[model samples]
Target: MGIHDLPHALAVHLFFTLSSVVIGLVLGVTLGILLSRKPKLSNVVLPILSVFNTVPGIVFIGLLLLIWGMEAITVLVALGIYATFPILKNTYAGLISVNPQYIEAAKGCGMSQTQQLFRVELPLALPTIIGGLRMSTVYTVSWAVLASMIGQGGLGEFIYAGISANDNGLILLGAIPAAVLAFVLGSLVDLLQTYTVPKGLRKRGSTK
Candidate 1:
């Protein structure tokens, strides 16, 4: 392809990355919260998730491709599943890590279980959850390149073409933008972590 194709390719790449990440974030956080309420179930489920997480993105995508037959859904499902793991694991860890004192304090105030989760636990856990989002966003951007394998259209087109043609320049065209996109998104997540941190925690950190 030529330089002119870059804009469309980039747009397609963004669609795949953002859509899958959104799907993953919602599913991961929801499952994490539900599992957090049942530590025993989490013990079984989380270990299974970790095993699945060990699978490579390319292999995951290829398996989905066989089932879905080269559709965009195939790519989205593969990418979304990959994106879900980090967010789910981190959200679970963050929720469970909340200090017992906080839980006790909330209970002392007669706070409902739901209120304690929303008002206390979730706010405190936001930083760790955002960290998972950062991981998912960056990894999804890289994995979005696999879209080209099924002719779904993305920066990967340039990457695969470059490899076949033995042209490093073409490969860089895809790679550079992907790296920059991941950096920009990851930085945004960092900003989110900063603002979402509880004021008490911030004060404690500042004093130290």
Candidate 2:
């Protein structure tokens, strides 16, 4: 790899990781909130999405490439869909598990369902949701590497080339950066959890 390659690889990796997560978070959290409003719907939809998640990443991306061709969008869509699952599940889980007392209190304050959802349930659910984000971010970093397989650029090119040439050094050049990126992104999400979650709710936060 050229000395200049690392910076370019880093940029590509971050773009893929962050972009997919942003798109995924919007779709996932929206679906999750919709499902949370209807237990029966969550039961049906969540299971279907979970089944999709069971498909291997490469296989899924390969299938998408047939329709989308070898563009970055194909990779982004696959990664976004993959990243959505945990966040959707956690959002539903977190909102459902909010204390009944809090719900009652929100009602007592004359808050409507929407207001209560925005102000009370979501704030309480922030830690769990952010935990899911951390998971998605880390997982997306790993998955983004596969983008190189389809001609989209990332550290995967280095790894794939290293494998082709049977050189560990080249593989490390790719892998070590990917690992550091995942760790750093995951850590940032954790730090976000502390800030985004309300200070009062922070003490009471529980994924359960």
Candidate 3:
């Protein structure tokens, strides 16, 4: 493959990564919030999510293929599952880690539950929540490449094709770009955390 083909492969990787991360973040954050409000439910739900996290990525891919066949949905579902745990776990931690004093003060001021969540808790938890999203993005991007095994082209296609053809240059072409992409994206997440986090929280090293 030429340098021109590299962009196409990179686009595939980006598409899968972005799709899976968005879906995973929405589901994970929503579930995390719901679970945080109901600790008893978390007792049952967190463990299941933890198990999903523990499952090997390759095995998860195999399971997806078995259920969904060798389709794009298999790759999307597998990547989404892989991306879910970090966001969910981090969101829960962030919510639970909120200062009881602040919550109590909000309650004393007669803030409604919705107001407390939107105005106080979520703002305070924003940094940690973003941290989870960063982790999920990195993980999703890296793994989405593997979807090429099922004919969904990405950087992994280059790596796999290179291996089959015994072309080190081709492998390096794919590998180097992927690593660079991950670094750039991770840095962007850090930049976002730096700017979006509250000033006091940023000072405490929680944001940056």
Candidate 4:
């Protein structure tokens, strides 16, 4: 079936992908900010996140299945876990990369703590954060395919059926759209960076 005919499948994929990205971003950024404020936490959290990142995606899904037993929630939770590390690492890196002098200047200008975060720190860190978000998006979309193993409808259904039935055309139908979706998402993120990044930062090659 074409993607249009599989609206529930599409919606499931979209929900899983979007929810993973958003949750990953929120958790990642929050933890990243906390780490920046407390370098001692880095010795603890960074290693843990790194270990999680090293775990294979399928293994994570399998563990989730063992706990949740083939539910839709298992799919989302697995995908979300897979989506998190990149955003977390990158957000921490971005915030840390901000020059001390720039922060001092903001303080010199009497910017409040909230104002400094929103206007100075976040704007400066946006490119890196977005880059992490792009990575999470691709990861989430790809991982959502595994949801079909648990009886959730997605493009993976076509892939699984195609493989079982030896239908090359059906396999291509799923593979093609998945590839296109990833490409489109990556390109859209690039476009966002181009337009949304501060002009000076873009000119300085910091936005890329």
Model 2 alpha-carbon drift over 4 Å, by segment: none
Q: Pick the candidate with the highest TM-score.
A: 2
| Candidate 3 C-alpha lDDT tens digits along 1-208 | 7678999999889889888998889988988898889998899989987877888888889878889988989998889878888998888889888989999999999999999998888888898899999999988888987898888889998898889999999898889988988888888889988998888887785522
Residue lDDT tens for model 1, 1-208: 9779999999999999999999999999999899999999999999999999998888988888889989999999999999999999888988998888989999999999999999988887777788899999999999999999999999999999999999999999998988898899889888877887887876652211
Tens-place lDDT per residue, model 4, 1-208, is 6555456766677788888888888888888888877888898989988888888888888898899898888888888777878888888888888988889999999999889888988889988988998998887788888888788878788788789999998787777777777788788888988988888898774632
TM-score of 2: 0.96
Residue 111 displacement (Å), model 4: 3.2
Could you tell me how far off, in angstroms, the CA of residue 153 lies in candidate 2 after the best superposition? Answer: 0.8
| Model 4 CA lDDT for position 115 | 92
Shift in Å, residue 72, candidate 3: 2.0
**lDDT accuracy of residue 11 in candidate 3:** 89
TM-scores of the candidates are: 0.95, 0.96, 0.94, 0.90
